[model samples]
Target: MSFHQEPAVYADLVSLNVKNLKNSIEFYTKVIGFKVVNETEQEANLSADGKTTILQLRKADHDRTNNRYTGLYHLALLLPSREDLALITMHLASNRVPLGSADHHVSEALYLEDIDGNGIEIYVDRDADKWIWNGSNVHMVTERLDAEDLLKDQPDPKDFTGLPADTIMGHVHLHVNNIEEAEKFYIDGLGFQVVSKFSDQALFMSTESYHHHVAANVWNGTSASSPKDGTVGLNYYRLVFPNKEILDQTVLRLNELSYETKDMGAYIEVIDPAGNHIHLVSQNAQN
Candidate 1:
């Protein structure tokens, strides 16, 4: 199936079922620097700034069975600046939340898992223009983080106080069994253009051209299959199209490719490489 080759989309936000809502919220605010924006009797929305809502927590048990339905590998959250990164690092260290930090040449990031074992990555981007590319493939590297230096220049925690919806979902990293298969499913099926590829090792795909909206690699797939049910993490991508015209075009495209699809209100869905569902959403003209 193919799409109208729509403009690339960055992720908006992802929701997760947390075993402990209050604990998760506290960890995010104290360790990750997110702030509460709104609450619907059953859920709490945490924002990076005041514009983007990073999380919608569904109160549930600390589920270890994330693999069956596919749990989260890590939701990479983008911070406004290096200072924001610095402030967050300090918060994590002070609170002593178990965490991991890395500097992927493309960006700097910190990794953590919620109570349910869903990984979360808080990160910041290096300027887009600064990205190094060779034949549309991005050059990324890993380096050690200088925590002491960052905390030395860290701002007061209050500096990041308030809602953080302004924060965008930088990108999502996933662990899949096959790169080529994933490529066929995500790119060919979903129509995301191949932005960069690490030879046959990994694939970074996007819609327009940022770096990579989705990076699927061979992390722990030694068995030649996904990690396992309750540990697969990241089942599908819910893509929302801008309008019905686009949605209809997508349906026609899927028909051309001979793939089965279901039409949802203002949206449509198709299965990707691993049979993970990708939903293409649009809005009703009158609504």
Candidate 2:
């Protein structure tokens, strides 16, 4: 099976509740280089390629996002190659966009924020063979990336228009109230395995031996609550499963925990402890 395809559980589309639909739409298209697939007065669907809707932006009831709240830390956009990352990096630099760059041993990443202070991470993963693994843990580190070398690897400087067709919503990092509780929900309940960890601060989980597909941290505070209804931040995101059997099993697990869920035919919708919604979709339904 393809590592990124069959039998691999991965994060698909992420929906965000933005303060300004128009402004957020423009920022995603203009700065982030996504194609607007569909748009209504209050909502817009965007894609890296014209065919797949990777992001959904909806206008929120409130104007401000509480940074201290337990919600999205960042939504990661994974590029297909290093060259693609360099091209986008150059594009952002040309526009004088302030960015934070990092080399995580397993991937090189560029971090920035939207107009509403929502965090975004654009990154390209290193080859799977190059990743370091010890037992069940995949080693990941945060260090300054060599931006100059990455820029030098691009095909051409002026070809930056938008993200490539293969770009995807790779992973999402969330701020949770507690690490143990987050792991219990995602790893025990959702069936993801712990792939990496950071003391009491963070935990990373994945399936099929890949790097983390979901990460959670308690950096904000152990008692942080979910974002209020009017606040801006994560609305929901799709967790694409390999098949109906897995999806059904996950739903059963959620029910066992007494968590609420809404069955939507092809997918089941559930909320995390922090109130972030998750749409669990079956692979057959995805097709």
lDDT for every model? 0.63, 0.87
Per-residue lDDT of 214-260 in model 1, one digit per residue for the tens?
Answer: 77666545244433322323434455555667667776777776778
Predicted model with the maximum TM-score: 2
Q: Candidate 2, 132: how far from true, in Å?
A: 0.6
**Please, what's the RMSD in Å of model 2?**
1.6
Model 1: residues with Cα > 4 Å off, grouped in runs: 1-6, 36-43, 49-52, 59-62, 65-71, 148-152, 158-165, 199-201, 222-237, 240-243, 275-277, 282-287
lDDT of 2 by residue, 1-287 (tens): 23456788988888898978999999999999999998999899999998789899999987554567888899999999998999998899888899999999999999999998888999999988899999999989999999879976654646898999999898989989889888888987889999999999999998998888899999889878887764788888889889888888898998898778998776788888877788899875751
RMSD to true structure for each model, in Å: 4.8, 1.6
Best by lDDT: 2
